[model samples]
Target: MNKYLRRALAPLAAATLGLTLLGGTDAVARPIGWTAAWAASPQRPSEGFTANWAEQGFSRQTLRQVVRVTQAGEQARIRLSNAYGTSPLRITGATIARAGKGAAVEQGSVRHLTFDGRRSTVIPARGHTASDPAQLTVGAEESVTVTLYLAETTGPATFHAQGFTDSYRADGDHRADVSGRAFGEKTQSWYYLAGVDVTGGARSERPGQGGVALFGDSITDGFGSTSGADRRYPDALADRIDRPVVNAGIGGNLVLNDSAWYGERGTARFERDVLDQPGITTAVVLEGLNDIGFYEAQAAGYDRPTYFPAPRVSAAELIAGYRSLIAQAHERGVRVVGATLLPLGGSDHYGAHAARVSDEVNEWIRTSGEFDAVADFDRLLADPADPERIAARYDSGDALHPNDAGYARMAAEVARVL
Candidate 1:
């Protein structure tokens, strides 16, 4: 056996991932149940990897965002977040629909969304709200569009920096517009929209008995995957399985430290992002690369001189972070699946010392048996000849992220453990 793998493979052998994690509606079992079909961990507005509307905020503009849901349902609800807002977020109107090309929506699929029996509501600073359920039949892996009309001068918006799909903008109230023509401007980040939940018989078609929440960083966020392709490993895994898979990945996120560019550390946000998610029976964690890579990249002069507060952490500390997350997940009866950090050789994030720390972490993830299950991605993606760098076929041009094919393999490896 590889030195990293445990002598006893009992945990690794549970490929079917037998677990009895389920939720009851209204604090009791009901015919209709809710499942988080899609999700995005919120991040504080800041200068990010690309141009976005975070700093400028929005005023008298309609924002249309597209997201892919991994579960099926005839009735759905949306969650909006102002987790980082300085003042209350005033929304004049909102709508949800089956997405058409670009900013457009499928005719007749559009549903007006109301919050707490009202068409409009205010989300207090650092708060969020969920819309009343709207009727709209949808299938697994369907793309949904959410349009919000911000009639007031909303201060800096809380958003997900790497949405992986185009978000359209129009100058006025276009909440009910099915023809995307009025929406001219676009960005690749999600503004305010946090999650999409589904319930009803249509969910019977979901791949499995319950949903799996992917809690990780950029790799899980599908950074290098083609925009609008929905080719993230989570998406690919949702395709292969019979259960819903919601992504809680935030690009550039860390396991041990909070970030202005990224979101909160894993331990700090685990409850809201993972535990609080509806019908989350399992959570797969694959983070910590940033905690290990941040300082070395800065010292090597890889740019982002302004990205300070870059605290260096030891491998042991990173392992402890994982332990904290694992304990929390298990307490909620959510099975925890741990993934090895990917090979980082030849990237700006890599140095001799950084490589050692990554190796130490991966070894523990594979052999420690703390996680209910393990997906050995390092062994699966590492270049056989080099053993330290990612295989050329899997490495995106930047040497940091994976291409679509690489994401596919990751999904396959994860499915084996699921």
Candidate 2:
């Protein structure tokens, strides 16, 4: 066939092959408005609030983590991070499935994941990658299991401490294992797992199936909520909202400073953790409590491995961080909702100077009118009589963090504004 004949035959051949050629590339399982259903902010490896596997890393072991999605989807993918790794990270194998009780997975739901069409790929130092989309169906508020097998030693892994939910590990190649018996050792941290995104599903009422991100510190991380109950404010908000809601909170996180055990500061991480969430239309930021509190704790000589030297941040500086997050989100066309710092009078964080700073910052968040919306968590959770302390009923014995009831109240307030 010559030019004329071949040109004429191309249309016929393409029609018969059921293909709509786009620049001669295949269109199989292409992304359809990916929305982040779940996420975890990455942290440097360190001795933390709980036992973490980062230092020991993994060698010929299968690490399994469970996360709950707030968006229903037809297909899904997982994001793996080597954010703080000094050397290239090699992923030998990985899998995803519906989560079951205690390290177990729902049978017949397992799906092997690939990266750039390969079963294995190397993540460059201080880098990350998302697995190719897998044909897995997950429902809103449902849990999914992700298992990774490291055939070789991965030195000092990057991870998220204070996951609140348990993660399990087993020796050998159990990437596809659905049973809990094999995964006996357990930890309370998420290792090298940054986020889980979904696409190729029904678009929600919002364009591109947009999701909302709840970004904050320990309270948003569900530190005081019963372990594994999924009672974080974001979890509760997802129940009330019509669209997807993802938790981007890190326990002990500061708005103006980074921590070895917590995570990158809110301003430094807002774009990647909140705005970058696939189709995130809005973000509710409830940070800065740690910034104010940690300073006092450090000055008072309270020592903990998770506690770093708290920077002496002024109220204006804290407000600057909030302004930065708002501006960045606005640039992305994502709405920003400001939240007041919760009361701290009864906690170790409360000092006269810290109290004055908190009051000033909270007032700005309430009155600045710079944010698209505001959630006055301080006024809402404050004791009516004292006004400086969290109400006894809502306090989780820590006096700083809220209990499950308090989290529910917070969700209601956020929903009312959002």
Best by TM-score: 2
Compared with the true structure, the alpha-carbon lDDT of candidate 1 equals 0.84
Report the C-alpha lDDT of model 2 over 40-127, residue by residue, as the tens digit.
8887887555477888799999999999988888778888888899999899999999999989999999999988778888888788
Task: Provide the overall lDDT of each model, using Cα atoms, as 2-decimal numbers.
Answer: 0.84, 0.83
For candidate 1, give the lDDT of residue 72.
86
Model 1, span 1-418: residue lDDT tens:
2111111111111211112224666354234456788988888988655679988899999999999988888888888889899999998999999999999999999899988678999988887777877888888889999999999999888998888889999998999999999999998999998888877645544434678889999999998998888998899999988788989898888888888778788898887787777777889999998888887888788777534667778999999999999998887778999999999988878997789999999999999999999999898998999978899999887777888989999999989999
Q: Which ten residues in a row are the worst by lDDT in model 2?
A: 9-18
Per-model TM-score, in order, reads 0.91, 0.91
lDDT for 196 in candidate 1 is 88
lDDT value for candidate 2? 0.83
